[model samples]
Target: MAADDERGRGVLTAADRAYLRGDSEYGSVQAERNARARIRDRIYDALRDFELLVEGLDDRDLDLVFEKRVGEDDGTEAFDALVSTLAFLYRGVGRTDLDFETVLREGVNLAEASEDRGATVDFDVTYHALDADHLLSKLDDDESLSLTEIAYLYESADVTPDELAAYFEDARAPDIEDGRVQSNVTDY
Candidate 1:
């Protein structure tokens, strides 16, 4: 009777039910979903941070940098070299679609316009946001992102793995039903 009581008590738990059905794969699925969510959040946060940093730059500063001649006679090279380097780094990370030169040209134009009008220009972060959104969408679609790409995205966004770990430290395990898991993120 004691053994029967113990068995009954164990059977009442969800873990016991899953164990009984040999459905360990659901745990893996839940883990994968959580990891994807963390990566998505990191990417979003990084893009926002970059946007704020760019927006806060003074127009006067941009004008000075734009006017500064590098290597004796570069002919108004406003961040062209820096942009090219960044573009190269992004390409190394699998972002083949980004043309840093185009972004630099547009930024220089805006800076020039702002300087001419004696007004601060707002930096446009639409492209960066779109890129981050695309990455999130790819994650949602179960597309396999390369490790190098992931590393670069995190580095560009200035998101640290420690930060992500801290953010999800208090997260609870998701509930599973019929091999489908309901996230704990929505529970709050």
Candidate 2:
């Protein structure tokens, strides 16, 4: 089966984009902030709950699972995003608290609940801050992360807001076009 087309990937609403761009002159800044906060909280909660679903199965090839699931006709990009985000957190952070029994039991319960709610979890923002590359880019460029990004980092990587400022302090700075040769020239 062919893979599902990507939908809602890295897509944000107009209001959200505007707010992130700091366009809050006459609008209710508080209201926009609150709205964005609520959405981010929901996504964070969803990621945590889904994390419970895959708490165990060590040594298993999750990449194969992801590949197979994505090839299914019923699969959606959302599933891909969820699995990718989960894998990133599990692998990148080296979290070893795995319990297959709990995952099996709770996974079913979570699926059932989500089905009843007609897809309660939103996976569109999975690429926001969950991905390592995106998060690193944000840190590398010294850009401010959105609330969703902050929540994902905290939940997935245990990164706190206070630590964000220094997350990349030790990394080499991005190259600049000052047009200079090596500082230490070797004379033969």
Candidate 3:
């Protein structure tokens, strides 16, 4: 009876459950932080597993797998974004598909959900190979980088137009369309 009472005491009461469910501001913060941590951990695990699976596949097979898995509408947006980012990261040694952009976009989406949510995932370092040369060449070839991409590079990667210009000749800032400033683009 004593052991049983102790075990019951350890169990969460209704009020405890409600607190964990985020009934207060502090509870809400804690809950969101914990949830984001879980999601980030799952994303890392998924990426690691995906990397192992793709290691044995040729480019063609990898593309097929990526297309099939990411196209599944049953997945949440975050899941699709995670898989697509992994696919883009694996798409080349020196050649990367622009699909990696989804990771940062997803990060911003999460941040939009809660400002604190963005702090949980560091999207910049994941694609360290996506240097100024690649981005500049893409821009030169008439591909456009979104404002989110620019702000992410600027804020997280410390990549400014001047820095890129030092790497690639004639690198110029992408023109901001319609003079609209993104919340993240402070210097614009």
Error of 2 at 103 (Å): 17
- Candidate 1: how many backbone clashes? 0
Q: Estimate each model's TM-score.
A: 0.24, 0.25, 0.25
lDDT of each: 0.45, 0.47, 0.48
Q: Cα deviation in Å at residue 135, candidate 1?
A: 33
Cα lDDT tens digits for candidate 1, 1-188: 22223333321344434443455333587875765565557555765665564678775665564454334333223234554456554564456565555655665676566456433335354433325446545556766444334433344455344432233336322222112111212221
- Candidate 2, 109-151: lDDT as tens digits: 6656644642333222243226756775776777766534543
Query: Measured by TM-score, how close is model 2 to the native structure?
Result: 0.25
Ranking by TM-score: 2, 3, 1
Can you give the lDDT of residue 58 in candidate 2?
Answer: 35
Error of 1 at 98 (Å): 6.3
Clashing pairs in 2: none
